[model samples]
Target: MTIWHRSARFHYRFATNRPVAPATGVVVDLSLNIVGDFVSHGGFRNYNPDITRPTPHLIHSGHGTMAFGGRTWDVGPGDVFVFFPGLPVEYADDPQRPWRYRWIGLEGPLALPALASIGLTPSQPLGRIGDPATVDRLLAEALSGTVERAFPPTRHIAMAWQLVAAIAAKPPAVDVDTVVHQLATGDPAAPPSITAISRRHRIAPSTVYRRATATLGIAPKAYQLERRFDLAQRLLAGRTLPVRDVAAQCGFNDANYFARAFRRRYGVAPSQWRSGQI
Candidate 1:
């Protein structure tokens, strides 16, 4: 679809895999533009109020002001915005000083939630990359012919996910210890999966595992298990609940499996351990 002005003074094009099927999470388009001396009617507007769009899209402005959501947001370098499926929105570079930007189109069941998980939504679409240079580098890589030629749609999705993660990552000065502690014991009521933790902390799974291991002397999964075990032990010691109930409280759905794990860790069954036999 032709969305920009004819004389917008920009280079707009898609990747090799311009149109892929409806996969769970895949990039349908990856384009970069250096908008300069934008035409009067060259602004971009895509209004799909009827939930017609099959995928979500995003815009990352290198610099400029664009009218969006009934207001003019000063989009500078590293500024990013998300457009949810079926949401009507318009954006364009400031005619006075046009900007360079990148756009990505993503589709899938997980696409909307993935964006939301990183604190991006239609109402609050604005975000800033922790490192502008890094974002530029990634944009360059994504736009490069080598990546488009060598990588498949899955790779594109992974790259897009990494870009989002980088934009959401904590600033460089944040303490590693603090990060480890937060991830290790952030929400006891709802223990997070590795992918959830990675998305929430804006880091890779390997990074999460390594940091947890280095700081706590245990892997993330092990740390979580230890937390559950500790809770289970406390509940067993203080409450007269059934073993199955205690297991459920500790995030375990299977009592028999919990008993085996307890035995493995404490050298006795949960009941025996609770009765001070071990």
Candidate 2:
């Protein structure tokens, strides 16, 4: 059910028995529980009823200003904005052209990280949706879940993920360079994989490879290998661990192979290099 509040600006839906889907690592339980369609309020600003939850808004049409942290942005159609918990939000309609928008309230332990994946963080709270129509359609589907009083709002929860994917399909603030950087550095044992990056970012493997090569002058796999060796050098020099242990630490299953690769990289065997015999 929804409450029509023309005076308050929102056709609001109360929270429901929403099912949270938690992931394996860095668990994100973000589920769509509430949504609203906001109409114009002339030029009067409306404060958020609660600042203890994460709320993301999509500007359906018109231009307006969203204020938080003593800063304001002139937002336009297709622009999406979010505010983390404990942050105040205030907005009003554009005088020349009153603005209308939609918002979804997300709650869970890992809601902030979930939003950050789509590039909406406290530091950078606003991002332009590349395909606003897709995002719009998904949100509309979720908005309809307000009337579903069933056990679990599966459709709403599913729509939330689809919406996130659609928004993430576009470059986050037009920075594929940053994505390529993330593709270069990670845990030494588990290096960056083009396949994983392609799948997660919803981009082609060739696109990732091209960006990696263009930015670092080497592919992502090469970059990860170079990074792994940098750690190996540090470990060989600083730690008393044996070459075998070092090999294992660097994700090398065979000592002989590690020695050969280390020799090729440094022009000397790892042991000799460690002993300053290079």
Best by TM-score: 2
Best prediction by lDDT: 2
Error of 2 at 132 (Å): 1.8
Per-residue C-alpha lDDT of model 2 across residues 109-157, encoded as one tens digit per residue = 6678878987889888887666677877766666554555542435555
Error of 1 at 67 (Å): 4.6
Model 1 weakest lDDT span, ten residues long = 30-39
Candidate 1 achieves a global lDDT of: 0.58
Off by over 4 Å in 2: 8-17, 20-28, 151-153, 171-278
lDDT of 1 by residue, 129-230 (tens): 655566667656765643336454455555656666776776665454666777788555346565544543457677767877988887777788788888
TM agreement with the true structure for every prediction: 0.44, 0.54
